[model samples]
Target: MRATVIRAPHDIRVEEVADAVVREPADAVVRVLRACICGSDLWAYRGESARQPGQRIGHEFLGVVEGTGADVTGFAPGDLVVAPFVWSDGTCEYCAEGLQTSCPRGGFWGSAGSDGGQGEAVRVPFADGTLVKLPADAASDDRLLTGLLALSDVLGTGHHAAVGAGVAPGSTVAVVGDGAVGLCGVLAARRLGADRIIALGRHTARTDIARLFGATDVVAARGEEAVAAVREMTGGHGAQAVIEAVGTEQSMRTAVGIARDGGAIGYVGVPHGSGTGLDLSVMFDRNIALRGGVAPVRAYIPELLPDVLDGTIDPSPVFDLAVPLGGVPGGYKAMDERTALKVLVTP
Candidate 1:
């Protein structure tokens, strides 16, 4: 068996590794049919953070069940499933409350778990709780791989932002970035009935997709300028809802500044591990409710799964490159260089 490993920053390698086996009664092993490079993966790749050498390096994936524990009743051998980035016990208090990302005992795949997501077959604990069953047909079909793979992360995260932001029909919304997640946010907003979608993006191609995903407008601005533009678009009233997709100081500021005084700001960026200098005085003055962070992906996956199956949402457009697992290094380079909005890896 082989897996993608990042031994160090900018040091990704594909090496043959030991095969995975079930370690618990709730565990299962998945033969990955498809996996993807996530935006958070880039944080470790570009030296922003440290990734254990050879740590399994992927989390968003879809696969066929190769084996399952005796107690697992919801899945079987050869069943296709979507594995959320975080594995959780669905019965946990948090999971029960629709916040699986915060499950007390949940383990994130690309971090403290057995390994990363970029591999041929991987050990998956809590199989019944973590993997979402997809239509049997999609398991063997490569065409459905792209969209099916998205249920694990970006698409789910995007849906989280929209739901959290309360995007209403005929409402004006502002999306704070143009990355895959940001574009997906635009798509999610449209699905929620937001009418005027303003995407703040500088890249022509990314912004174009934002429009395709349902953004009614685009702005090539940054920092305060971008916030100003979003306000101007709303006739100085600011957007009724704002999706902060970029986890940066500037992105957060822009999201806060461009939202209507009483509007909600739903953010799902990875926080880039930076402190936000939020002005409490202003936030209080505006009566704005600012909330958003790590999306409880598992909570949204089930809801968004049908849309992808019925062809109602084409989230796959975010993939600018799809590479084999062995070429995982290129996935890092492509995203780091801004050559790709999102990269998908086939294992």
Candidate 2:
């Protein structure tokens, strides 16, 4: 079998590796149909996140079950499913309370907890607890389900960002960054009932996608100018909710600086050190709420899965390019260099 590995920053290679197998009774082995590169993957690929030689990289996937343990009843070999980026033992205390990302038994592949998703097959532990069954029409739904795949992480990450920011009905929300996660934030904010949605992006292509996702306004400002534009859009009071989808310092600053007093900031951008100290006096005096971290995607998937099935929300547009596993390095480079908003890799 072959798996994707980041030999070093700016260098990704698809190397032959040992095959993955079902070693645990609670595990399921999946034959991946498509696995997309994520900004999070870029973190490790770019030397921003810690990783070792031969670490299997990749986390978002859409695939068919090749085998499952006896204890798993919700699925079988040949069934297509969407697994959340975070793999958790559903019976844990955190999982029971709807915080799968924090599950004590949860395993985040390609990261510290477990293996990764960029390969021929994946051994998903706690199969019954983590993978979601897609519609019976999964064959036809495959190509159209990229957004659902995105939901397994980025889309869900975006939704979590908006919710963390405290977006509400009739409130104006602003999003920083125009990447797949940020564009998805626009969609999530609208779904959460934000009436006026603003997206801050410098790229025309990305900003266009943001508008399509329900951004009522687009600000093509960079750095502090973007922050000022967001404030000006909300009548100088700033947005009631600001979603920070870019992990860089500039975008993080834009998210916090553009938020209104008493408002909230939801940040879910893989945190490449963008999270810093805010003016304590300003935040404390204004009563602003700050919330976000790794998104609890598994907890939110059940609610969002139906929306994808019913066609109410389509996140597939984020996948502007798709490639085979062997071409995954190009996929990573395209995304890291901003040549593509999101790249899908089929393994």
**lDDT, candidate 1, residue 193?**
92
- Provide the lDDT at 138 for model 1: 77
Residue pairs clashing, model 1 = 7-53, 56-116, 57-116, 58-117
lDDT digits (tens) for residues 1-347 of candidate 2: 88887777777888887677788898999888878888888888878887877677888987889998878888899898888997898888899988898888787777643557888888899998899887757556665667668768988899999999998899899998899999999989999899999988889988888989999999988877887787777889999898988777777677778889889989898767744646667778877788998898888888888887788889888889989998899998888889998998877
lDDT of predicted model 2:
0.84
Off by over 4 Å in 2: 112-114, 274-277
The predictions' CA RMSDs to the true structure, in order, are 1.2, 1.5
Candidate 1: C-alpha RMSD to true structure equals: 1.2
- Candidate of highest TM-score: 1
